[model samples]
Target: MSTILVTGGTGTLGRLVTERLRAGGHEVRVLSRHAQPYAVDLRAGGPGLDAAVAGVDTIVHCASAPRGDEQAAAHLVAAARKAGVPHLLYISIVGVDAVPLGYYRSKLAVEKLVGESGLGWTIVRATQFHDLVVRLLDGLSKVPVLLLPAGVSDQPVEVSEVADRLVELAVGAPAGRVEDMGGPEVRTFPSLARAYLRATGKRRPLVGVRLAGKAYRGMRAGGHLTPEHAVGKGTFEEYLARRF
Candidate 1:
């Protein structure tokens, strides 16, 4: 068993990764700002970071900024290098290269950092999580008619599946950039929202609005969904059943 350090242990994805690593009989350490079982902060360069990663053989870097903060990725890569961590696994989003979304741009920058860092690394790009879809549906339900960006498609993967994949990457040898992982099927926002509403027994009408711009055009072209390699098993309907 190897000692693995997870950068975003408190988050939705990080929490699951940490649990999986622990369950696999690996020594797990978490990096976070707040004090917990293990505490370290990449942004502030906390002292605990070095100690937390001292003997760690692998680092699962799940911490990321909201698209606009590209500098954070550079810092994280540098920190991992300085810590002398042998392996670094970064979890990234799909369509980062095809779409010009701010968040995707940041993720792309991070992927570049990991590639150039010369550290043993595996960069796994995945589709939007099922939780993101659930959150969007819940937030849009407050409006009388749910307004969704038309023509945009997404293949949402389960967070648990992504977490499992991250663990697999952590334990394996670094493959600079791995294949994209996506859901079983590609789906549109309005259709997904309606399906989720019907599954949850909520009566909300969905209004599809075609957005005009580069972002909308990119999404309409199915830039976000992976076409070639999709390894996840859960479908949108299964995710809805479990969530609602």
Candidate 2:
């Protein structure tokens, strides 16, 4: 079995990937800011990383900062190269190029760094996760009413499915910019929120407000969902049924 190093091993997606890798009989190591049994922060250079990458064959980069921070990607790439890791896999979001959001921009910048690093790499851009749907609803519920920023369509995929795909990518050869992975169906913000509310048995009023900008308009025009690559098996309704 190969030794795989996962960045952000404690996160929602990273944890699942680590579990799957372990289940498949691979030696798993995690990179975190805090010192764990097999942890090293990429931002802090030197032997800490050397110890982490000592015998690892693959590096799955799942760590990310807030939406606007582009420098983190450069740091990660530099560390991986310095460590002489053979294979690198980067997890990114879908619609990063189509949408003009700060997070998407940051992701795109990272993609560039990975490409130029001269490392054998694969970049998998996935849709918003099922957990993100719940987070969005919770955020809206905090306010008296749920206000959607006028436009934006999302095809949220199950986190488990995304994790599975990442694992597959990790095991296989480098496929630069692989096909986009998304949920089974395309949905609007208001509709998704209402469905989520109904699933959770929460009685919250949802209000859709149009914002004056091309970014907002792009969302409303269904810019986020990928019609050609809707490969995920879990539907929004299926996800809710399992949870609620």
Candidate 3:
């Protein structure tokens, strides 16, 4: 069995990927910021990354931050190339190229770095996760009125399903920039917020506020949606029921 290294192995998606890979009998190495033996920070030039990547056949890169993903990818790519790693798979967001947000731009830049890193690579883009939507609603519910962005819709997928796909890709041959993944249904913020309220039994006045910005406009225009590839099975309601 091949040994695989998983970056961000402790995160929502990466954790599941690591678990699945191990369950499949593949030796898995988890690289994270705080985990021992491989606790290398990817953002700060990734010191001690070489040891974590050494002898690894494939690297599943899921570690990312809002600010320094490009730098992190740069360091990881350099390390992977140095270690002569064969396959490097990345998990990205849908519409990263179309979205004008700073975070999305950073993610797109990382994707470019991964593609041109002179290594066997696969890039898979997924829509927002259900956890993210719940976090948004949870934050919005803090105040008496739930103020959500007007005209913004989301297709949130289950993180576990995404993890499954990533693991399958990691174990297989490199397929560059494969099909995007999305949730089963496209939903609006207010609509999902209603679902949240229903599941959590929280009653509050819901209001939609139209925000002005290129990022917000991009989100409102459905740049982050993948209705054609709506392949995820779990629904937001189902996630909510399980979450709460």
lDDT of 3 by residue, 194-230 (tens): 9999999999998989898889888989999999999
- Global CA lDDT computed for model 1: 0.82
**Candidate 3, which ten residues in sequence have the lowest lDDT sum?**
39-48
lDDT of each: 0.82, 0.82, 0.94
How do all models score by TM-score?
0.94, 0.92, 0.98
Please identify model 3 stretches exceeding 4 Å from their true place.
none
- Tens digit per residue, CA lDDT, model 2, 1-244: 8999898888889999999999999999988777396565555545676677666788898887674235656666677787787888999888778778777778888888898888899999888898888887888888677787655678899999999999999988888889999888888888898888899777877777868866666667666678788999898888889888
Backbone clashes for every candidate come to 1, 3, 0
Q: Over the stretch 85-182, how does candidate 1's per-residue lDDT look in tens digits?
A: 78989999888998897778778888888888978989989999988988888898888888888777788988999999999899998888888898
Better model by lDDT, 2 or 3?
Answer: 3
Which candidate comes out best when scored by TM-score?
Answer: 3
lDDT of 3: 0.94
Candidate 3: lDDT of 117? 98
> Of the candidates shown, which would achieve the greatest lDDT relative to the real structure?
3
